[model samples]
Target: SLRINKGMHVDGNWPALGAAAAVAHSLGLTPAQTAQAVQIAACQLPMSLYLPVRSGDTSRNTYLGHSAQLGQSAALAVASGITSPGNAVREYAHVVLSKEPEPFDDTHGFHLLQAYVKPYAAVRHVHYGAWAACMLRPALDPDKIEHVILDVYEEAVIYCGNRAPQTPLQAQFSLSFGLAAMLGWGRLDPWVYREPQFQDAMLRALEAKVQVQVDASWTQQQMRGARLRIECSDGSRYEQEITAVPGDAQMPFTERELVDKFLGYCEASMPLDSARLWARQLLVAPTNTHPFPFWNLPQEKTPC
Candidate 1:
């Protein structure tokens, strides 16, 4: 099967379609125009390969940024009177699957309700093992750790099986590496994916101890979860199971966490007060009826 892991890299492919749809909506395009925009995006969708991700190539990181830019351009092109063949999507769909296009069963309901916001820089599949390891961090000493076992759903293991990854992208996609990194650093934020962390002797030792297994129960339930067990040389064992990571609706981030996350990103470019003000304004922008704010960053050479 040409699935996400086998032949396709989903992150490289899906963003264009999403960006097209979102831009079309924001521009208030009619259904037909929106369809045209999507068709244009579909026709130009970049082909994806999983091999680069497996080898930790830097090109893999550029896929999403390029996809998003392509998407935005596709939507704007449509708004500027560009036209795309109406059947581009179904044609490629049939070609890709080598089967007739089947209707989507909308009975599964709206996709927005199923969305998960990410708290860490790693892939979603890596989160379960990482989260479980973090839960056990307080109890175990990194130096004395003898072996670690990560039992997770089959798909997670299949898609993200890298061990002792040496690069940022590889670490992001590696369940075993994520577990060790989280245990060593006590967190799985972007900073943990740096070169210093990659070269850390303790983290490397922890990665060597990890053994991943497939848990049939989680696979059958289609659940994103992991059971992590660590054995230390001191004749001690620690184990924990994480059924979900934060950002899942059932385990969502608190309001404070959300605000902090937003500010964290914003503060990199603007001052704290400006970021806070931008956060407030952006959070309430959807409810506000004023003309769409393009960009309201203060240009004044003084603090607000």
Candidate 2:
């Protein structure tokens, strides 16, 4: 998604910081040193605006490579005691932003999330792109569909429509591909980007028929909306307009949902019981408790 939709390389920040901190911890750096290391790494961070999507190969590893390396480099630099945190961040910022020329795009996935998708995600259990996919599905007939037309605000068109998406990351950033994927598979799942599914003949046909246009009337900043119009081969027409998405400050994810997501991440590696135990300890543990019992949780033994 960072490849095309949003030019800002924010996805790299957390991983780089995490790597820096972990290295600092291993080196037994003082709090000040650790902070300085993180600062230095952040300053040295580079954004990869030029996506290799046009060249194919959209693996997660490829997208995260630069950020991950920079993060570890920061940690290593701090461990070596040669980097001055304050000056490093300042100088790096000047060098990256001022000394170099970079292309800037006005629309980004972050803005779409903050302004539109999150609200819908919070309310409908789907992001705006996914919601558009779902809403467009019923209008299309698997056997007789002619084309799909999506009319949305300018930023939506700018951020979501990618004509040449070669990788899953590019696919996710594409409004047309995402919607087509949802329609082709009846729903979008992480696995939808894998194997035969990525090369699914039916989805490619559907995606080829998607066209997105900007609605000139939605010129205001707060106008976050989209209209999906379908034209069938039988000369029939269907339209759906979404003026508001859910999950804004007005609508929120329930506490149970948050807990479910947290547990899902934990259970991906360990047993559910272990995840639950750790979660209980992490949530209820008193502030500044030493030894951090949650971190001491036993590793899962591999089944031979």
lDDT of each: 0.80, 0.61
Q: Give per-residue CA lDDT, model 1, range 109-217, as digits (tens).
A: 7879878887777889998888888788888788888988999999887778887787788888899888888898887776677667677888888888899999998
> lDDT value for candidate 1?
0.80
- C-alpha lDDT of residue 154 in model 1: 93
Residue 82 shift from truth in candidate 1, angstroms = 6.7
lDDT (Cα, 0-100) at 19 in candidate 1:
83
Candidate 1: residue 34 lDDT (0-100): 85
Q: TM-score of model 2 relative to the true fold? A: 0.58
TM-score of each: 0.80, 0.58
Clashing pairs counted in every model? 0, 4
Worst 10 residues of 2 by lDDT: 117-126
